[model samples]
Target: MSNEKITIAKRIAKELKDGDVVNLGIGLPTLVANYLPDDVDIVIHSENGILGVDAAPDKSLVDKDLVNAGGSHVSTKHGACFFDSSISFGIIRGGHVDVAVLGALQVDKNGNLASHKVPGKMIPGMGGAMDLATGAKRIIIATLHTNNGSPKILNELTLPVTAINVVKTIVTEKAVIEVTPEGLLLKEIAADTTVEEVQSLTEAPLIVSPDLKSFDVAA
Candidate 1:
């Protein structure tokens, strides 16, 4: 994985608290599982009918039938359970999940998310994302600051929206942003990144947090 992706994953991992039940979306969101602190105890839920997700297993230990939402082979934490998708989604739609970390194609200033569709690009289909977006108590976005130099954070969404006004926080390689009723707030910036660099890559105006601090992966 690229450093940018690892940085974003590690930053999002810090948001996971003890006793939290988190559903991780495919791609970068799945990487958050690897960075979760050793002291933190939380259940990792995969929509594909597994809970208590553990780290990726050694190749020799890989279980073909045991995979995450991204279809990557993974180990299970002690006491993990399995069920049908119906029951898994029931846990999600029932608002039992504490947090949902998702990826986005675009997230507008209003916290609207666009992740499933990319215009004419063929997609398998919107999977459990729509349900997770609305079902989770807290929604966090983990994505690149830009896509091929184009800002993913925008004043208005140009792609199909996954859920409107659902995202609470966004973690990118350059910064950590919070979406509030007022607007987007730049809460933290990467140690190597400058505030101006982050602003230049973001289409939406940012309100820099008074308590803004440099992002450290070790923290």
Candidate 2:
């Protein structure tokens, strides 16, 4: 792959608008902060306790108490504020976040997302994902086109759902798919990927834009 995680993150950062309050989920979601438009006043929120958080920190300056929910040390820009978990979740539940970018294990055709435990594997339970998905003005899922080369989008999710009909768009290495009442719409495809390649990985039928242009994620 082409360091797909970085490709997905860079594209997502470009989609953000100015002055948006964004909450980034643990892993890939956190990478968005590093690529956001420096000119835009985008404020990042972490579910654990930090709001207006900064990007990844230098390992030498790690602060145990300034970690995100994923246990990764986080820095902060000037004017960043700290609050309790209860307050952070309240912002999510109260719909204060403009966008929430989350990493998902699976996303169904109906825009339902499954990010928690699997039947055979134990993992961290859903913490603020449910709240962020349901309450954010926009929910963006960042994940690979596949897991171990197997599709992650399914006809029906095998795991418990975090939010139903809440995902607005999915950003993957190969394409950017929008969730609509009809089906997944192929909004854009990476420069190196073909429509056929995207179709091969999509569990549902994909709709191609008549004016679709080649996607250079870095462009």
Report, for every candidate in turn, its global Cα lDDT versus the true structure: 0.92, 0.86
Candidate 1 stretches with Cα past 4 Å from truth are none
Q: For residues 101-199, write the lDDT of model 1, one tens digit per residue.
A: 999999999999998997678575789989999899999999999999999999999988899899999999999999999999999999988999999
TM-score of each: 0.94, 0.92
Candidate 2's C-alpha runs over 4 A off are 56-64
Q: After superposition, how far is residue 99 of candidate 2 from its true place, in Å?
A: 0.8
Q: Which candidate gets the maximum lDDT versus the true structure?
A: 1
Clashes per candidate (backbone, < 3 Å): 0, 0
Best by TM-score: 1
